[model samples]
Target: MDSSTTRTKMTVEEIVDALRDKIVVQELAPGVKLREIAVASEFGISRPRVREAFSILEERGLIERTHNQGAVVARQTAGQIEALFDVREVLEALAVRLATQNAPKGTWDVFRERFGPRAIKAIETNDMDYYVEAVNEFRRKTFQEANNEILSQSLDRLYDRTRVLIQRLVLMPGRAAAALEEHRQVIEAMIEGDAVRAEQLKRANIVSARRWFQDFKKFLL
Candidate 1:
């Protein structure tokens, strides 16, 4: 065993990222308490550092802070989830519409090349993590190509919460294939310059996924 050690101090952002990963993977499920001292001990850091991380996570909608209870993982009720999807459905529909109309030449071509195959490959290999990453990447590219900074920023707030649910959704039996196919159809509409069709397809996909959550909330939420 080595006696000497050299370790750099972890930044608040690093701590936040680590905690966020745990939330995303459901290792720290919704409503789990996050005690500063416990976390500090686990990370070999001070309590103040963990507090800073908790503040950032709270701002990002991944954690909620209560006066008496301190911090707990953000828990979405069915109503909260439904309301989020309502906003997301509208915003994403607009994003798809705008992306279809405003994306620069070859943008969709590049996106399809980069993400479409990877999503299918992820499904074929049953790599749910990779598929989730691919799906998230596709969303980032779509928002970027939409060229609406305000819209993108607004939806991003929802993403920190929505993505957690999406991970669960994608892992359900038969969902990966359905999601991949839905995404491919949306991309095809975008590439073909059918803004209406693209928007419709994107909204439908989101709404359908929302319904799945509604039906399965007992296990999912």
Candidate 2:
């Protein structure tokens, strides 16, 4: 029996995440065809659900749809990475500022509860994936506190692609501890209702990360 005959069932979101992870880790290289029928067969899902997952991946910039070739993983260039980081820095900084104004009481408490100790633990143990997850969760909480759907959606679109770039940045020498401290400052500013200060701290944090990527690009690329 052909191994391809076996199938695994998963929800549409699960399928999207699975495919996105593959793309992020370069398991699915750029320009590889994503045949809907084959994917549907593998996942034991319908073509329609697979299509939905494709659209989601496309929106996240993990894949692209051609006029006739269907979907393939998106190829990113250095200039594209620069532009994405520029836009992300501005938008995420704005998110923190808005969050200062709009955040509900106890929001910072919840964020701290989820990330503070866990973030430090991840860094000390060299647990890259766990650290990245904590950072992403922190970003999500910032969006939620900001209470702006449009801003949140815009940032969401860039996040998956950004994650691909930063997968290595967190592991850079001295980066993990610095990032934790930066996040702490940003959260403190938001809790103090200091919009301008929070925005500045957030932008500085993002810029610092971008610089790390620039310095390390020789190895990463």
Choose the strongest candidate by TM-score.
Answer: 2
Question: Model 1: per-residue lDDT, tens digit, 1-221?
Answer: 12121114577878888898898777899889989888977887778778888988898788999898899998878888899999999999999999889986667776576556776787888888777776788899888888999999788878867877888787777778887888888988888999999999999999888877877778886
lDDT of 1: 0.83
**lDDT (Cα atoms) of all candidates against the true structure:** 0.83, 0.83
| lDDT (tens digit, per residue) of candidate 2 on 1-221 | 34343334467789888898888888998879999988987777778889999998987889999888899889887788888889989999999998888877667866665558887888899987887887788888888988999998898778778766787777779888888888888888877778999999999998988888788877665
Q: RMSD of each candidate? A: 3.8, 4.2
Compared with the true structure, the alpha-carbon lDDT of candidate 2 equals 0.83
Off by over 4 Å in 1: 1-11, 41-46, 110-130
lDDT of 2 at 133: 80
Clashes of each: 0, 0
TM-score of each: 0.79, 0.79
What pairs collide in candidate 2?
none
TM-score of 1: 0.79
True-vs-predicted CA distance for residue 92, candidate 2, Å: 0.8
